[model samples]
Target: MTIGVLVLIIISACSRVDGEMNRVERASGGSPIQVVTTIGMISDIVQEVGGTEVVVTGLMGPGVDPHLYKASQGDMKRLEDAEVIFYGGLHLEGKMTEILEKMENKKLTVAVSKDIDRAVLRSGKDAGGSQYDPHIWFDVKHWISATETIYDALVQYDPTNAEQYKKNAETYINKLTELDAEVKDRILEIPENDRILVTAHDAFGYFGEAYGMKVMGLQGISTASEYGSKDVSKLRDFLVENKIKAVFVESSIPTKSMEAVIAGAKEKGHSVNIGGELYSDSMGEPGSDADTYIEMVRHNVNTIVDALK
Candidate 1:
């Protein structure tokens, strides 16, 4: 080959190598990472810890129930492209877990809820007793531990920002501590006998267990479970016999079922009013008071205390 032709080929190869090096440098630089979370609550936590360092997206939107949610084509694309994916495992996202598990080896996927102690969770709630209650966030104290788990995960993923993540997690936890106190004060206002929280589903079990209240729902711990006629009748009878004053409804699910429960109780000559809608199975919209984990707990406690007290 001519010397000029050989030099031209060498120049072409060098240019290609330089382009590849530039791409690598871009990736290694402190560019904001892409994080995808399964639920809004986890998304909020990620945002708190990662701050502007991350571009986080929540797969489940407002009022979207994750219990029965199936990921769309868009979701899979987002999952594949994300630098990290956070899911609240323990069967919370029932339909999406299997798919996510298969991709565990290929992607940086994490189950944030797995950080909670297994003993603290209540099992045997689902039909076959295999399904555990996945609502650890209902208890603010439990969520404090979840935050620690998240902080640790973030630090591991981005060691350079360890101190920043820790500081952010600490700040959020302090707010949560204040929230726990507020919830206690608010719940104490309810009369002991009137502290019964009758709802559409058994989602509030942990919340009730945390605070001093008797929680009953038409459906089991899972919203996916259908409320049999027996279940409905039994709950209605219990409401009438107990003369429970207020029955609450959830924001994500249809309130028609809960309203029917109220009507059924009233049919038995028991008067029960519909209290304000409770934020259950999902958190509030961004920027709303119920958006943050702390705000959500406080809102629920205040709502319950006001209606039951």
Candidate 2:
């Protein structure tokens, strides 16, 4: 459905729920804080930091692309009901940014990545040169910063559980620290010459910068941008020159573009293979090795190391 129609429907549905929401909010002393997050990454962090004090509803699930996601009627209702909404800003939710911004006046809407230092963020020329990469969760340290943001937001909205939120943030930060160290160590297994990552999109710039890999993408930072014939040819030539054995695909993006790249490289006398599917904009299915953020990082690192080493 068109976003305009979706918004209208949501407004109507929300008006009906307004009275009931007020009643629930009045009795919220014993209930969890109602929260809505744009993507799984934000949802997971909020859940970890909020603990028993919050109930998070993630709008985008596993293998869903935030860049291309639009709010459904159900998603709009969820946002209307939420006491607070968290999203990975920097225009990650390109289609839903307007609605989220409009909701801010009515609710405690926050961009989890807002607290990140601009100096540390990777600025790109894509999207009219004003965009910073929104995939901050790829870098463990950056994500640790985001965890603090989520914790602070939770505390601000629900001060009664400030102590619990602080504790949860501390524990999760420690885990992220250890995960960062582990990723570095595992990435060391691949030789420097093979420390190049060619993926479906430029979603891994932060990851490449953190882990010391030269990253290239078939498309720009936002998957919404298209790649031309020249772009594909240039990437293929780079693959051939470097003798790179593997190129990776993303879970949320179609692999056809990467497959085309592989075929082009073969035609030019290079035999590059599909390394493995990487969770770029989204995590794996629940109960899988990459279900959580930590596990997702581990799975991606293991995949890259095994294929490149």
Candidate 3:
């Protein structure tokens, strides 16, 4: 092996016990399962369902865009040390797909959205043509399904803790179901004519579908997909024609593009206020109001409703 490869293996080995034993040690009630997750949205649900049984290390954190993210060697080490790995698939982590594929045989690598119904998935075109949008967590019902997928994966990998996973998943899913109803109701507070959600990118398609709003983005599904001045000018004209009152900025995307849209709207004798900063590709920072998945959804809904209504 090359010296660099050898060093990484040694560092990973030194960081954890052999065979990810703490997971194997579950029957003995040892350390929790070693889980490594890709995005923060997936990380939250896994933690909720796994509870005290799994210690999840999230690779992408607040404001980190998964579309443009490239895994570092340290991330590779963490993935190697993990007992089980969960990722948001459907090309969410497009750059990391090969690594995840290679690790599946050695570990129980799973896509949390694996069991979600294909019919409901949103498709968008990139330079590579069409693909399913990876922002499923924006749709509460879809995430409810993803929660069960997480439960199954946890049970599959660590059956010893099956009972715990089931209990936690049930509780969390119930709350999400309630959240589904709540948003549907809260969205009604915004007059249907005014419920348009425009953002820096098309990350909120599922959100618009679930909450009864028309969604638009300056960019396409993947932030890696470039948006030109023409795209912005077109969106600006649409906003002015539609009389859209607000546009949202994403935590993970630069605000300059959206700012350009706002400036463009002003020159056309129309005023479009920034609705609020919404947590799109990533959740809020730890301990913040929008940190968790549910709270993040709530924050987005409240921001949208307050700004548009």
Candidate 4:
């Protein structure tokens, strides 16, 4: 069923936690405010800001693509149980946009990207599609801004714990601020000519704009756009013409298209290596180096810098 239909069907049958009850229950010593996030990035930020006062459950995990992810039955229950819901917004969760929007009427449903400055974003059309680019996390400064948004949502819901949330947000935002600087410095490690970042899709436009790299992809902004041989030929031609040495594959996307581009480039004697796998639409697994938002950014930076430099 379409998410729009699901929003009408299942949601009408579900009720949300009452605001007064939420405050009283917490005041009377109840469970942490149940916070649900659509993607791991937002989940990490909400967890960092909410700290002990919130229980954050992310619907999309490592290697999951938020651009095309749909709400499953279990996901619906999780949303129903949440006191607050945070999503990447900007149509990042394209299929779930309606449900997420309607969820706001009953609870503190937030699109963290909504708090971002529109000036910094690349439109999907700009990136090769229709909506605004949703990969804001690629820009650490933007993600730090998003952290503040998550912090505000938590404080709005649970004002009693505002100070703690403030402390956590400050700490996390400071780290992100440092990360923003580090990414810029690291990107400089590559020669200006080699700073081109080619990936499976145009998911790195924000990264390119923020960190000073030229980005290209076999597919458009969203993976929903199917790639054709023409797309591969074009990218392959560009790689050969530019003498681009490497391309990166994204964890959430299948590697076949990129592999095809690499093969086609080889046919023309332009040997291009798969630079490395990047955490584009998803984070890494638990216990992995890119497990958290900060680590994920670190891993991507190191991978891109190491390969291109």
Task: Give the candidate number with the greatest TM-score.
Answer: 4
What TM-score, computed on C-alpha atoms, does each candidate reach? 0.88, 0.92, 0.92, 0.94
Whole-model lDDT values for every prediction: 0.77, 0.86, 0.86, 0.85
Expressed as tens digits, the lDDT of each residue in 106-220 for candidate 3 is: 5678988889888889995661233788889999999998899989988877788888899999999999999999999999998879989999999899988888788999999
Displacement of residue 257 (Cα, Å) in model 4 is: 0.6
Residue-by-residue lDDT tens digits, candidate 2, 1-309: 667546745575565466356445634456888889988888899999988878889999998988888788788778877778899888888888878877765667899889999988888668423368888898999999989998988877777677888889999999999999999999999999899999999989999999999999999998889998999999999999999999999999999999999999999988999999999998889999998899999999999999999
**Candidate 1's residue-wise lDDT over 85-191, tens digit each?**
78878788877777666545544578887778788887736722336788778878877877888888777667777788888999998988887777877888988
Candidate 4 weakest lDDT stretch, 10 residues: 11-20
Candidate 1 segments whose C-alpha is farther than 4 A from its true place: 1-29, 127-130
What's model 2's overall lDDT? Answer: 0.86
74: Cα error in model 1, Å: 0.2
> Positional deviation of 12 in candidate 3, in angstroms?
14
Model 1: ten consecutive residues of lowest lDDT: 2-11
Q: Compared to the true structure, candidate 2 yields what TM-score?
A: 0.92
> Which candidate do you rate higher for lDDT, 1 or 4?
4
Candidate with the larger lDDT of 3 and 4 = 3
